[model samples]
Target: MHEIISGLLEMTGFSIVGWETILMWMIAFILLYLGTFKEYEPLLLVPIGFGVLLANLPGAGLGIVANELVMNPDGTYMTLIDIANNYGILNFLYYALIKTGFLPPIIFMGVGALTDFGPMLRNLRLAFFGGAAQIGIFSVLLGAVLVGFTLPEAASLGIIGGADGPTAIYTTIKLAPHLLGPIAIAAYSYMALVPVIIPFVAKLLVTKDEFKIHMRKMDREYPPKHEIKHMRVVKIAFPIVLGLVVAVLVPSSAPLLGMLLFGNLIKEIGPNTARLADAASGPIMNTATIFLGLTVGATMTGEVFLNLQTIGIIVGGFLAFCLSVAGGILGVKLFNKFTKKKINPLVGATGLSAVPMASRVANELALKYDKSNHILQYCMSSNVSGVIGSAVAAGVLISFLG
Candidate 1:
């Protein structure tokens, strides 16, 4: 009877019961609820939530494990052969996909394939808003330093403000691998809540008049018919030229920017490679996202995630996101002060790298203030520019801080 009871307890994962494990379970459930019921980045949150649940179920051995070098009893590093012998499947996946830093760039390739750079090209000045939005990253970096975090760790934490999940993961994995889980969670969570967060901030900083401001008419409405052909030529050239320039200026950014430009080039090369572009933006991207979410969540073991520093990261990350929104809004306000052609301040809040979502939120707010307003095209310029700005910022941080 005693033996049977013990076996049952072990099999049921009850043998490892503890407050921390219970807390982690609750956290995972909350994530699941938010993902399912609230419909917030469900594709990412669901997988990550499930991974957290799997990892916390004791004795499963499905969670990640340290490489043999770190686990060796003699306090000496081990060879690849030794590490292979000790690897868990999740650990293998994590090391293979994430630690090697292969997945994020691939994800960027998909992003590039799906992106339309036309809006940005049409409105070149708005691109600067993306750079302006990055002020939050530096602000949070200083804040993290003041609150007790190493430069590398703070850099990883500060990137949560960029609202670019893959960039945050890539930067954190390079600079501060230990903080990857918290940083990724904060980045994605804030991104999922962009609709809620951006509006609140826009309302706070932007006046009713500023919200009602409209952008100049889109080129699509009043352009020479032959302009379409010229636009295609420019689109093809833009990625190639920009890629070369960025690669020259920031070598470390080459891998990510290279993949992005390559994907864009594939998209621009015409209908012959429609299948390739579709594959990049569809199956390939979805697969990468699933693995990325799972590996990231598995890293959040109760032993590592439940700590005072985790609390600090969460707080700092939220502050960074809020400040980024404010920075973008303030940037437009500053720009308007000097120019007769004023931009809608609401468009500035879309400067984070959440893409069309941020732009949509800005448009929605504008409509609420005045139904005739349609600022999505203008906001999209800033939105896409934010993607480039975040990548560049990540490169700069890695170059200086890593």
Candidate 2:
């Protein structure tokens, strides 16, 4: 009777549920609560939170398991069958999808298909703030190295400042694959918190008068003496020219930036290529996001996440995010000091690559100070440029580090 009961208890996984497992469960619950009740990045956090739970459950063996000896004899990766046997299904999926560095660029294609560059083309000068926002990435790179991280590890950590989850993930995969879980979690979580982070930083740095600065009024007061001719042609040609330039200058980034420009190219080409655009933006992107969230969360086993390096990532990533936001705000302020035509600091605040969300947050903040100040278009100018800037920054890092 004793032997039978012992065997049953051991098989059930009850005997193995320790404080560490419970702690991971609590962390998973927190992610779920934030995604569910707070409605913050539900698409990402919900799947990730559930994956964390599934991975931590004792005896499930669903999480990504490490095996240094699983490579093929020829130095290629193992086959899916071999991976599934040695690790779990999650590990196999991760190796097949993520380790290959395939999904992030595919997601970038969807992002490009969905993006409209009209706002940016109309207001080219605001793009400077987007470039200015990249200061956070490099600054954090140096700071991280000074604080004891290796050069590549610091580069991966620093890319979080760009506020582009795909860029961060891609950069980490190349430069610091070991830190992917913490880096992805930090990047997306901060991106989701755009509504809060933008406002928080704006409050600290921007004055009430700066927030009240209406961009349209300034444009009306100092109207452009010249307008871009054949705007449609420019839009169509810009992505192609830019892609070629990036290919020459930063070939490493061609994978991501190339796909993005390709998606944009198809979209700009109109109905002739509409199907490709739709497929990239809809079903393909959705599938990639699901796999990304789940696999990334699976990498968050207690042994991986519950470490001092994770603590550094959590803290360093926040600083990088804050610095990026502050850098944008300060860029506008500095530019305003010299220019008669003032730009709203809020426009700069939207320079994060979080896209429409960051732009929306900045637009809302602008409206809070002046009810009629609609800066969404102006914000998009910086927002979209930030996406390009971040991807380029990732490319630069990969070129130098990887």
Candidate 3:
């Protein structure tokens, strides 16, 4: 009777009760609640939440691991065979997809396929706001170093400011693989909260007059009917030309930029390649997202995630995001002073690479200040440029710091 009771307890995962495990479980529940009820990045958070639950279940053995015999005494390394034989499936996925640094770039290919760079092409000047926002990345890099993190670790932490999840993951995996889980979570969480964050910062920085400043419609500038053919030609050529220029300047970014350009090329090729574009942006993207989220969350076992370092990362990430917003708004203010065109400062808040979400938030704020203001197109120009800027910044960091 005693032996049976002991076996049952062990089997039920009740025999290994620990504070860390309980805390992790609670954290997982919170993620699940936010993902489900709060609708906070449900696609990513739901899978990640479930992965956290599975990892912390004690007896499941679904988290990362390494064989004792194959691990170096100095804690320096493990063999591929050791990883395959001893680690869990999640570990395999992490090593195969993330450690190789393949998944994030592939995800970028999908993003490129779905993206329409027309707005940025038309506005041109607004694209500079994207580059300005990247000041947050470098600022946080210095801050992380001051806080006692290594250069590579600082680079990884700094990337969370980009608000580009794939870029954050790519940079972190290369520079600080161990911190991937925390950084990814921080990046995605901030992105999911863009609506809350952008409004707060924009309202604080910009005046009512700036918020109400109406942008000139693209139709008035180009007369859509007159420019359709020229626009299509530019769209087809932009990615290729830009890819070549970027590759020549920054070889480290070639893989990511090449794949992105290739995907965009397929998208712009029109009807004949529509199926390819659909596959790249739809099924392929969905599958990669699920695996990526699960593997990232699985890395956050109690032993790895429940630490002071994690807290520091969370705080640092939040500060980085806020600074990015402020930088963008300040950039627009500077631009407004220099140019007679006078852009609405509110659009600057969308420079964080969160795509339509950040742009939409800015638009909503503009509407609140004045219903006549329509800056979605202008905001989108900055938003798309932010995607390019973040990727470029990641490459620069990987080249210099990695």
Best-fitting candidate, scored by lDDT: 2
Tens digits of lDDT, candidate 3, 305-368: 9888899899999988998998999999998897656788877778889998999889888889
Global CA lDDT computed for model 3: 0.85
RMSD of each: 2.7, 1.6, 2.6
Clashing pairs in 2: none
For model 1, the stretches where C-alpha displacement exceeds 4 angstroms are 7-12, 67-85, 217-229
TM-score of each model, in listed order: 0.93, 0.96, 0.94
Model 2 score (lDDT): 0.89
lDDT of 2 at 44: 86
Q: Tell me how far the alpha carbon of residue 248 in candidate 3 is from the true structure, in angstroms, after superposition.
A: 1.3
Better of 1 and 2 by TM-score: 2
**Per-candidate count of clashing residue pairs (backbone under 3 Å):** 0, 0, 0
TM-score of 2: 0.96
Task: In angstroms, give how far residue 43 of model 1 lies from its true place.
Answer: 1.3
In order, what lDDT does every prediction score? 0.86, 0.89, 0.85
Shift in Å, residue 393, candidate 3: 0.6
